[model samples]
Each structure stands twice: as C-alpha cells, then as structure tokens.
Target: MTILTIPITFDKSHLITIGEKLYSESIELIRELVNNAYDADATSVRVTIAEDEIIVQDNGSGMDEQGLRQYFNIGSTEKRQHNRSPKFNRIRIGEFGIGKFATLAACGRFEVTSRKDNFAATVTFDKEEWEQSNNHWHLPMRLEAPEILKTNGTTVKLNKLYKKFKLDDVERRILEGVPIKAEHFEVYLNNKKISARFLAGQRIPVFEGSEYGIISGELILVSNTNFIVGGPGIEIKVKGVTIKRDLFGMEINFPQLNLLTGEIHADFLPITSDRTGFIKDSPGYHEFNKVMRGVLQRVLHDIKYWQKQKEKKKNRRIVNATVDKVLNALKKNPELASLIGLPVSPEEEKQKTEGEILPKKPRVKRTPAQKRMVSKILGPSAVVARLKIGKKGISCQLDHFGQDSPESYTESNIIYINLDHPLYVREAKNRERLIVNVARLLTQELTLLKNPKNARQAFDTQSKLLKDTLIDTTP
Candidate 1:
C-alpha cells in the first residue's frame, strides 16, 4: 500500500486575494496635497482640473534634496529631532504625518517637483507597480535629482484619472476641505476665486482681527473674516505624500451647516480624505476645543434667540389675521353687535350722544420696536423687549426700564424685520441697498404669486414673509 500527504503554510495577513486598492478614494488624495501646500507656507494656492488631468500648485517655500527624501518617507522618523511635533507652529496649519499617500487613490501616475536655493528635483509615483506588487503602500518611482528647475514651489500632477472629474465640483470640494483665504493665500479653481460664504453669495470683507490657536503646538489659526466667508478649506501637516478630495460634498457640508452659518478658523481639527470628515480627537483637539467651547454656545444662543423672536412674530401674524376676519364678518352680520357690548338698535344709537354711547371697536394691541432694539443691542446678555398688540399689528418696547442707549444707529440700519423671513443681508451702513434688495426680491415673489394658476396659494403663510413697519434707529 502507498500513501501520499501534502503540507501547507500561509501568512494570515496576506491571505486576502484583492492585492490592488481601488483609486475611488479621491477626496483624501486632494486633501493631502492641500495640507502639504500649507506646510510649504503657501498663501496662494491653485487647483486646476480637466477631463483627464488634475493639477494642484501652491506657492509655499519649496523643498531641498535632503528635505525631499525625508518628506517621501511614510513616517517622520527623521523629523523627530524636535520631539513635541514636526510641523510648523499652529499659524502654519499642518500636524498629522500621513496625508501624503492620499493622492495615490486618484491616478495611475503622479509627479512632484520642487526647488530650494537654486537646486531642483522631480519624483514620480507609478501606481501600476503599487497595485501589482504584494506591498501596495510605497512609491514605485525613484527620486532623481533634476539638473535644473527655476520655480520654488511644489506641483503634483495626477494622470490616468481614476474617476470622472468636474471643475466646479472639485473647486467646491477644495473650498470646504481647505479653508484658505483669497487675499492671504488666494485659492483659485481654474483661475476663478470661489464664492460660497455670505448670504449675499459673494465674499465677505475681512474682519480686521488676527488670532492663532495652538493645535499640537503647531502654528494653526484662522486669520481674517473675509476668507472664511469666501471659501476657505483646511490644512493638514503630514511628513510625506499628497491627497486629493471629492471636491463637492466637503465644501457644502464641511461644518454640518451652511458656509455662512458659523464662524471659521481652527487649526488642530485634522481631517480625513473626503474633507468633510474632521478628526475631533486629534493631538491638539482638546486645546482647540477650549478656545471654541464658549463660542459654540454663544452661536446656539443666538439661534435660539432668533427662534423665539420668530415665534412672537408668528403669533402676531395670527392675531392680525383674526382681527381682519372679525371685522369683515362684523360688517356682514350687524345683529351680533349687542352681544359684544355694541349698540343694539339703529334708532337707539341715533338718539345717543355723538361719541359717548357707542364704544369704539376694541382697540387692537401693539408692540414697540424699542424693546426689540434693546434685546439686539444686549443680545443674550439681556432679555428681549416686551410687546403690546395694536389694531393692525404689534408694537414692541424695551422691557427693561433701567436700560438706555446714548449711541444711535443710522436710519439705514434701523430696519424692522419680521422673523419669518430668512434673508441674511451682509453688514451694511446704508438701508437703501437692503430695502431695495428686499423690495426686488419680494416683488419677484409677488409676481409669481399673482400667476399661481392651480396649486395652493403662493401667498400662503409657508411661502411668504411679511414686514409692515419700520422704526428709526437714530436717538
């Protein structure tokens, strides 16, 4: 009798069959490049896109030969000379050490070129080799010292495009992922500046205040007011590689709200590839959170305060509608006047004195605008003004008797707006611009309402905003 036996040995980690990693992870790739740009000290960045090509160029300080080799490594083992962190002070915006490889997901080929002190070099990443090889994480191309290069910045060219690309969409994604300023480090998508910050749909002016935050003890801070309002993205600090992003979702949903919905500029908030996903517990997250702790609460308080004002306005509208309905019904049914304590008979009313016998229709109540003014001036620090009803609308008065303001606002700023509307006009000193803008918008809406042929009324509560009065802001 003859017997045969076979022996087998395999490593558990390498058993999986799919050795090739798909390049569908586009957003992270773009993010890596953007973060690297920040590390290069770039104030002006450009992201250019075509059907088959994606280019990211930044004007940050370029790299030297030794710097290039160290940057190519996956980890910053060489950068550990200064132990706390390898990135620049927070003012510069990078902290993590791994965003560089993100770009590998976008193309079959990628190239990087940088120059420092009159010397330049180029490096290529071959994706085919990465996918075909057993270990898919390392760069396939060798770093060759170039004979000549004039410019002193880094450029990454991603070829054999992995996914369909669109310029508008990609630009938007960059805006959300890397909140850079147009003036400080102007960012352009196909040479056009992005505008997605203000309700006006244009760039907001830079608030003249500069501040910094210490995330991982790197210089990370959001400076200026205008850029955040324009279309600012994010900055990462990794030792090697560049990443790309999806370019659409990140810009619109970066902070879980509209671009104009909240304040911007916090460094330590590391990000993942899509650009919308932020790392909440990064090395310096807690320190960064310390600065933002009260800020978010104040923002929430402002929103709630606005909401309460809206509720009051809604109630006012109902009361006004009820008053009008009662008046109309009263004219048609004169018989019920006596039940409401009005004159019973026409002859009896004629015999009575001119003004003494008949009671005036119960005076409708009103609220004074002064009360609302005080609330706005004091904001969450104080309570809102009290209100009284009038025959047609409501009058609001400052609720606190001890409060007084010698300072006065311009007539243009003294606008009485009902809370039901969502028109957030930018900061302005002239009311004409705001009023005219509102008028044009409302007129357009009215035109639509007049021609609403079949469905529910266009002028219904859900579709329109009503503002019937204006009070002066001057003392």
Candidate 2:
C-alpha cells in the first residue's frame, strides 16, 4: 500500500484573525486555553494574570517533535482521532484545533513550553510577525534542556496583552466556561482554586431515548427574572464542558422568567468552532430542546402547584387570626366565659346534639353583606379547609367542623371557622365583617352554654339579630 501526501493550502494571513473571527468575547480566549489543558489530561491547571502577560500552566502529558507538529497543524483532528485523554480517559474538548491559535485574539504574542519523556521544547508565536512575514507560517522554536518541571506538562504565556480585564471578572467567566467537573481535574486562577457554583434545585432528565444519548441535570428556581439573563441558564454542556451558557441563542417559548435556571450535561451536543454555543439546527440540539420543553412544562406545573400552596397558607393564616381574636374576646368577656361550660347530663348532650327543642326554621335569613363575609373567609369553592389555628397559637389538624355547613357548633372553647364556606371566602375579607361574624358566632356559643332549655332558641335568635344589625353597616 502506498500513502500519498498532499499539501492543503490557505491564506496564512487568516491565522491573524482566526481567533477574532471565532471568538467575539475576550473571555472566550481564556476558555480555549483551559480546554487545551483539559485535553492534555492535566490534573491541575493554573492561570495567572501578571503585570504584562497572562500565563497558563498545566501538568499533563506534553508534546514532543511530532506532537508539536500536530499541535501547530492549522485544523488538525489529532485530539478527535485519539478521542480521550491518555491518563484519565477524559473526553477531549479541543477537536477543531483552533484553541491554541485563539490566544492571538487576546494578546499580541505568546510562548509555549512543553516537555515529554526526556525531550522538552519552547515555541513563541508573534502575531505581528505572522501578519508581516510575507505569508511565512512557521513560528520560532527551540529545543531545550528540560527545566520547566520534572514532569510532563505545557505552559502557555500570552504577552502584550490586547485588553485589560478585572481578575475577579476573569475568574467568574472561567468558572462558567470551563468543565471543572471531570475527575482529577482542577483549575486555579491566581493561585485560588476555582470552584463550580453550587446549583441547588430539582434535577431534570434530558434526551431519555435518542440516537445521540441522554444527559441528566438540575433546574434551579430563581426568583429574579433579570438574573436569569445575566446569570447562567439551562447550560448546554458537551464533553462535560459547558458549550452554551444557557438557552440564549436557541428559540424557546420559556414558560416563565426566572422559572428555569440549570445546567444540562449532553456530551453528544454539537458545538460551533468558537465553542461558545451549540449548533442550533443540528438534530442533537433539536432533540435537546424537545426534551427541555417537556422539562419546562413540568417545571411550570410545579410552579403553579407551589403558588396554590402559598395562597392556601395565606388564607389559613387569615382564618387563624380570626380564630385567635374570637378566643381572646371570649377570654376577656366573663359573661361569655361563664356560658362556656360543657353539659353534665345526658339529656343536655342530646338537646345540644339534636337541636330538637330549638326553632325548626332559621330565625334570620343571610343578608348579602353577611353572605359576602362568609365567602371571603371560605374561598370560592369553600369545599375544603386544610389549615386550623387554636387558642395556643399552635397549628394542628383538628376536625372542628364535620360537615360543609356554614359553622360547626361544638361545646369545646376552640373556634374553627369553616374556611370552605362561600361567605367566608367573600365577606370575611373585610376586617369589620370578620369581627362582626366572629362576635356573632361567639354570642351564639355563649347563649347555648348559658341556657340548655333556650340554648338552641337563644343561639338562633342572637345569630339572626347580629347578622341583620351588625352587617347592615357599610364595609
């Protein structure tokens, strides 16, 4: 078999602007180098921003003569062919071969020192010279005695800084960009270790069944919708590295703002040459959107359910306040308190239970105002009330009312307003109506306790009179 070698030709000047064309943001340049370190299987990578230059150093298998040649190849796929790191078997992140050259986007010149086995070499790239060298493509290089470190590794120095940036801002960008999740891989910026932000939320699954693969991630519910734009969103991750910060470029009918913030780890997702985002039209990306759409729907459902729970809690709190006031009023009024004793005889218990001796008809009809008060406390349906507050100000599940009736008359001193009533839902919303209704119930109970003979009759009379007179006033 014969192997034929053909030279691939392109404008060498393209190298000068290749980085700029690929990366619009300056922070992307830093990500390119860190990805290279990850591709090298470096356990630890340290990036330093000095007075005049930025240095990125890693401890991993470095390059020899052949390796360096492959590294400089304009669009080499050496990392892709290898597929994984030699030591850790980590998925390589720099397959497009533009990462190293991307440094030119941030600096005018840069130097790389690498060592492997007993061989070590240093190479310097001058962007100005590359652009002016009459199309010459070679960078200055030298073979050297290994002094970089005892172990195999690579160090890249970007000098003649193109732009100045805050160290803190740079660190934050790196934190969001790099794949710091791989095992045995750690990154340090200015000697301080960069830790992945703690994302706390519910986990959602992506691409459950597809030709590509499935990835799992979590959705953190954020309150501030604006933060979702500035902070990271459903990050699109490939090879454990976040390719897209969020669903910024993609077309998504997001259910709500600040509703879905999270990271997805889909290694099969295709990315652009700059590695800043994913290929939007690719089948893999489309599938990701499909899976995430389902996730967001479920997230929206959860949001609705949570809101309902909160509203219930708020209504329960209002019922609790009304109950507390009634109890306090009963405690202060001695006459009402004296009427609160339990029946000692079986006959009295029967009379209270059956209401046989009481009036057969309702002495007073519900006025519209009183009716509205009941609706306010009970809510629209007034079918179920799950929350109860007692005299102790303690919350418990007590069955004070057995039926869906307007009110439950019990000998116990505790007042359990039926929040499920229509009137409580409507009129009890007003403070004056709530107080009047509470007083009406209290007077009814006191009359029942005062005279078992007329207890039922007096209770009915007082309830009707209170409704007609007290609720007649304007809300």
Candidate 3:
C-alpha cells in the first residue's frame, strides 16, 4: 500500500484576519512593540508620532540575521525556550512570536532595522504587496554597514498609517499596558517620559503564595475622589506586561470600589492569545481567582469600615451645628430661659428681678453619686455636646437606651437623649427629622424642670421655643 504525505496550510488573508482580531485597538500595537523591546533587555524606548508615520526606537540588544529570521517566524518557540534576556536577565515579556503581526492592524507597511555586533540589516514588509504576491513567503531586506545603526539597538518604522495617533492617547496606552515600572526600563512618547500612574491612598500590600506562583502587588484605595475619573479595576499582569484590568467578579455597587486601582502580578497565570483575559479553566488561573477573591474580601471590609468612619464624622458635625443653633436661640429668648430654670444674662436677670411675680427657688447642684450615674448612662461611645447658658454649663449626651426608656431626662446640668427611642430611631433616617426630634426631646426635658405640674403651659412653652429655634437662621 502507498501512503500520501500532507501538510496543513492557510491563506495569507488568514494572517491578516488573525492580526486584526488579536489587536482590536491600533494603540495596542504600541504596547506589543514596547514589550518586545523590554524582552530584548532594552533600557529605554522612544516612541515618536508624526503626521503620517510612527517610529519606535529602542536601545536594546539588536538582532542578527538568524535572530531576525526567528523573529519573522510565526509562533516561534525561541523566546519561550530562553525566557530571559542575555544581557539584563530580564524575564522576557513576549511569549508567542505572533505579536509582531499586530503591526499589520495599524500600518500598511512596517520596517524593522537592527544592528548587533558586526551585523546590520533592515527588513520591510508591505501588507498590500504581500497579499498581491500569491504564494510568496519571503520579505525584502537590505544589508547595511554597522555604522548605519551607530549602536546596538532596533528601530521599527510604521509607514502608510491607517489612522492618526494622538500623543496623549499613546501615552495613556503605555501607562496602562506597558510595564514601565520594571527596573532599568523607560519609555518616552513625544520626548516626554512615560511613568507608572501613581495613586495616593491607603495601599494594601498583597503577597500570597499560590500553587502556580506568587501573586504579589499593592492594591490602592485612592483618597482623592477627583482621581477616580477613569474606569475602576485592578490590572492583572503576567511577566511585567499588563494583560487586563479586572475586578475578578467582586464588582459591587459600592462607591468606594470606584476609587480602587492597582496592579497584581502573577507570572504563571495562563493568558489567552489576545492577552485580554485569562484561560479560566487553567489551574493557574483557578488558584489566582481564588486568591484574588480572598484579597478582595479584605478590601471590601476595609471600604465598609472607611465609609462608616466618614459617616460618623459627618454626623458629629451635624450634631454640633444643631446644638449651637439651639444655644443661640435660647440666648435670644429670656422668657424661655426663665421658664426652663436656666440662667440668663445679668441684664435679663435684673429685669426679671424688678418684675418678680413668682417666688424664685435657688438652683440645686447634683451630688457626686448623681454625676457618676449620668456618666454611666452616657457611656464612652456616646456623642456629647457642651454649651454654656450664662454662667451655668449644660451638657447634652446621645446614647442608645432601650426602646422602653424615656426620650430624654435631665440630671443636674446634663441631659441624656436616648438614641434608641422609637421616635428617634425612626426619624434618624432623615437629617431634618433627626434634628427636630432631638430638639423636641431637649425642650421636653428643659420645660419639665420649671413647670412639672402645669402640662398645658409646659406644652405651649415648648411649642413656642421650638418654633423660634427651628427657624431658618443659616445664611
């Protein structure tokens, strides 16, 4: 029996289709090229954008003829085999050699010129010409003298561009996509150096060991709300290159998550061909997802704690402002102060003495035991406000008493308001209602001190005092 040999092959158009699909954004090509330079042990990469062309030049270990041949070989395993740079020993950023195809998505023609030791050459690939040449598999190259390159490095010139590239857009892409934080590596766009985006906030350092590798980096809870303009998520990186920004399914409606931004590095995480997502079925990614879920749980807890603290501070301010308004109103109404058994100014006292109708009772001071009981009821966590009424000082304390407790009670100069009262807890949902409820409780306690027997007169006095105190005095 005779056997026939066959080989798998694809059309040139398939190459173009793969490239366009792999690199959906034209700006992504810049990241691919920059990463290529990084893997070459480059110290610096300069990207120049012009009206009609874009140039990427890097000071790295340039390729020789054989190296250039391997570079053009699609899906070459050379980089995967030797995963570190010879010069700087950097963990190579490029895995699948097919990344070079990404250039076709942005330009009609691209040229690569490199010089290493005594070898120097330039290879040009024109998309239009390559497609027209039915079965041609070779590209045009020109040998140049070593002096042409000046030093060892590579320069990629993308000509016949399909679209215009703004410097700001390119810089932003590099900041997010490239690993500018790598040691001894720098990227420049339009002569301006591109640096890693810095977030100012509480940074939680993460260093967890997974079965695949170590998942390490910092997660920042940005303090400035203005800086939270862009999309919110943490960038997942492999081998220093950012693969994608993700929340790992921990996304929620919490506003604090909007301020979340940082990077997580897991070199062993298996990424898809486009590098836009992870291969979820892989064991490496499973472990990574599990670890991230645990980390985010802690982050969520911190965000909740931060939110509570902020609300607590805001509530304290509101309480102080409300108390100040009440004190100011009390000073303006001497009649109200007299009925509440509170001391008034000396001038008001002189006028009241001149027209004395009812006999006055001397103010009674509290004993040490009563003071201790007030302190115990208020508790350490209670919110306290203090103000002076003429020469006497008054203290207002808010604390949680059982629902059966009275709304408020006065002990000497101290008034304790029950926060857990049915009315208070119900009205606390609205700030205005909360202020009114507190004022009503204060009026009840103060009025009871002077006229405990006359309910009708006491209610009338409280209504008058509350009307005056709750007036819109804020200007």
Candidate 4:
C-alpha cells in the first residue's frame, strides 16, 4: 500500500462566492459587521454611509495582533469557545467568524484598524490585489502608534464600494439585525441612535421553557388601519439578533393573521451557516418550533374570538334596524298589525294623540328556570331586539337553536330565529341574504300568530309583510 499526502486548498473566488451567498444584499453586510461589534462587548457602534465609502466604528474591546489574526481567519472558533464577552459577559452573537468575509460582497477593499492594550495596527485587504496574488494569503498591515487611537476600539472602513448604502436602509437593518436592546448597548446611523421598532397593537406575551432553553417575546395583533413596518410575520431571533421574519406556515391558514407582527428570542436554537434560518433538524430547533407553534395557536384562538365578537356586534346593529323597519311598516298598515292581534283603530290613535293615559301593563321578568331555558334555546351570545306595535310588544332573538329546530318559533311575545337552521346557516354567509332570512322569519311568526289554523292565509300575509318590510325600508 502506498501512502500519500493530500492537500486541500481554497481559491480566492470561494470567498467571493461564500460572501455573496451569505450576505445576499449589500445591507446585510452592515448587519454582520454591527453584530461583530456586539460580540466584542461594544457599548456603542456608529455606522457612517458616504458617497464612496462606508465606515463602522465601535467602542468595543479592540483586538491585539493575535486577535487580528483570529479575526481574519475563516471559521475561527474563538467566539464559540468563549461564548461570552469578557467585560459585559454578554452572550456572543458571532458564531462563525466568516461573518467578516461578508464585506467582500459589498466593497472592493476594506480596512480594519484596532487598538488594544499597547498595540495599534491597521490591516487593509484589497480584493483585486488579493485575488491576483495566486498563493499569497497575507494582507497588507501597518503598525500605528497607540496614540493614533484615543480609546480601545475598532473601526472598519470599506472603500471603493460595490454598492451605495442608504442611511435609512442601514438604520433599519441594524435595528432589526443587531442586539440594540442589550444593556448599555447602542447603535447609531449617521449620529442618530437606532431603537427598536414600535408596534401599536394588542400585545400577546410569550414565555416558554424547554430542555434546550427559554423562548420569550411578545406577539402583536396590529390594528387594522395601522401600517406594519415590515409587513406581517414574527421575527425569529437567536442570541438577541433577528435571524428572519416568519409566520411558521400560518400566513395562509388564517386571514386575520395578516395583521400579526412581533419578535421571538430563542438563544439556544441552532442556526444555519448563514445565520438566516434555524437548522430544522436539530433538537434545539424542534423544541423552539414546538414552543412557537403553541404560542401561535393561542394567538389564532384570540383573533378568532375577537372576529366573532365584532361580527356579533355588527349583526346586532343590523337586527335592531330591521326590527325598527318592521314596527314602522306595521304602524303604517293597520291590517298587518291586526293579524298579530295589535289593532290600532283610528279612534284609538285619536285618543293616544289627545294624551289620554292608557293603563300600563306590568313587565314580566323571567325566573331562573325560564332564563336557563332561553339560554339553552338561543345560545349565550344571542342578539335580542324588542319593539312595540300598537298596544302589543314583541321580542326577536337571533341565536343557534340547532339544525333540527324550527327556522323560527314564538314563545309568548318572543320570536326566536334559529341561526343553526340549514337555510339560515347558509344564507348567513351573505349580508343581504341574512337580512332577507331574518325578515322572512319575523313575517312568518307574526302572520301565524292570528292564522294558526290557516297555513295558506298565513303564507300570503307573510309574503306581503316581508315585501313591505324589506323592499320599502331597505335603502
């Protein structure tokens, strides 16, 4: 057997490819750089965008010579090993050190200047020059006196930019991608500090613990008229930095979910190499997903409940208006009122107008048993409308009385419309159809009150009443 050594070498183009794939957009490069500062225990990071260059300055624990070497090294494990910042003990945000290479996609050349302890140095990496040097991997470095930097920090300057950076876009990306909410940490774009985006809506808080770690955040059900900054979706963050905005396969499931916007943090979830998504196959990711699913289920339930309440309120308004129209029609046509045993003669009308007081009938109150029976027949969320025609009062209630129950029935002066009736449930999907169904039910019940033994007469009377109430009153 012959033993031979095999060497694995990487081409300069590979760096460009990786950077383009990882960053994708020029704005993403800024996010990676800002996060690097955060991992270095930076309390303040200032990003400046100019016509020809972009600069990122941080007041973090800057790197020494060896630290600079580690910074340039691809896929360095130093941050993963430490896992926390030396001064602040903040959970490190940078896991794959290749984040630095993201600059290659946005600029032709970039320079890093750092000051730490007694050392101060600047390293410049010119993309064109580096690619031309076949096997040479070292970058140009200049030693500067410690006085060059007034404080221990790092400044990265990207020159000969491949793309222009917009101030607004940079500020937004940093606000979403960096851990600005961390204690003592602040990010600025062109001297203006970046703060978390505010959403005005109902906030649903979430906190869950799994074997991996704890997931915590608030989900917002944005107001219908309010414009969401980034549209609908919950931002998923790991280690306080947002990875992506996701709805977790719920965008199409519920129409009300289009108004959802918020963020969730799960520091223990394993992320993909680009840091744009989680590793779905990992145990940590599964646990995080489980927790998020439960949270979203609750959100769905709340949204449905709110929608049902709103619909009920709207329907009640419609029902009241319909009832008023029915009463007005009955008053205009004494013949129809007489069919329901509420005759309003001309003499009685004159007496009423002359202020002749009529004896008031005592109102009847329901006993507990009767109230329970009403609840059972008309559901708890039933909408009730009451009106007086001539000397008689009538009560109309809309509720679910089961599909097997009559479309409508009268109990004393009360008329109940069965929402669960097959015809009613079908017509309820349309506003106009629902109004017609309710008017038809009310006409049937009122006409049948007097002509209980005559089905043909009741049907004719109901048809006339329905036409008068719906056609004459519907505007």
TM-score, one value per model: 0.48, 0.73, 0.81, 0.78
- Alpha-carbon RMSD of each model: 15.7, 8.1, 5.9, 5.9
Give the whole-model CA lDDT for all candidates, comma-separated: 0.44, 0.66, 0.79, 0.80
Q: Write the per-residue lDDT of candidate 3 for residues 215-326, one digit (tens) a residue.
A: 9998888876577434667878888777887787667655557677788999999887767778989988888999998998889998877765665565566568777767
lDDT for each residue of candidate 2 in 56-143, tens digit (9 for 90 to 100): 9999888888888877888898878998888888888888987887787788988888998888998888878887888567888899
How well is each residue in 196-252 modelled by candidate 1, as lDDT tens digits? 443332222212122334322111123242534324332232222212211223335
Residue 153 of model 2 has an lDDT of 91
Give stretches of model 1 more than 4 Å off: 1-24, 77-90, 129-150, 199-305, 321-475
Candidate 1 vs candidate 4: which has greater TM-score? 4
**CA deviation > 4 Å runs, candidate 2:** 1-9, 200-207, 223-232, 247-257, 334-475
Candidate 2: worst-modelled 10 consecutive residues by lDDT: 387-396
Stretches off by above 4 angstroms in model 4 are 1-13, 117-119, 145-151, 165-171, 222-232, 250-259, 324-380, 388-393, 402-407, 420-444, 450-475
Over 106-173, each residue of candidate 4 has an lDDT whose tens digit, in order, gives 88999999999799999998888988998888898899998788888999999988788777778778
Top candidate, metric lDDT: 4
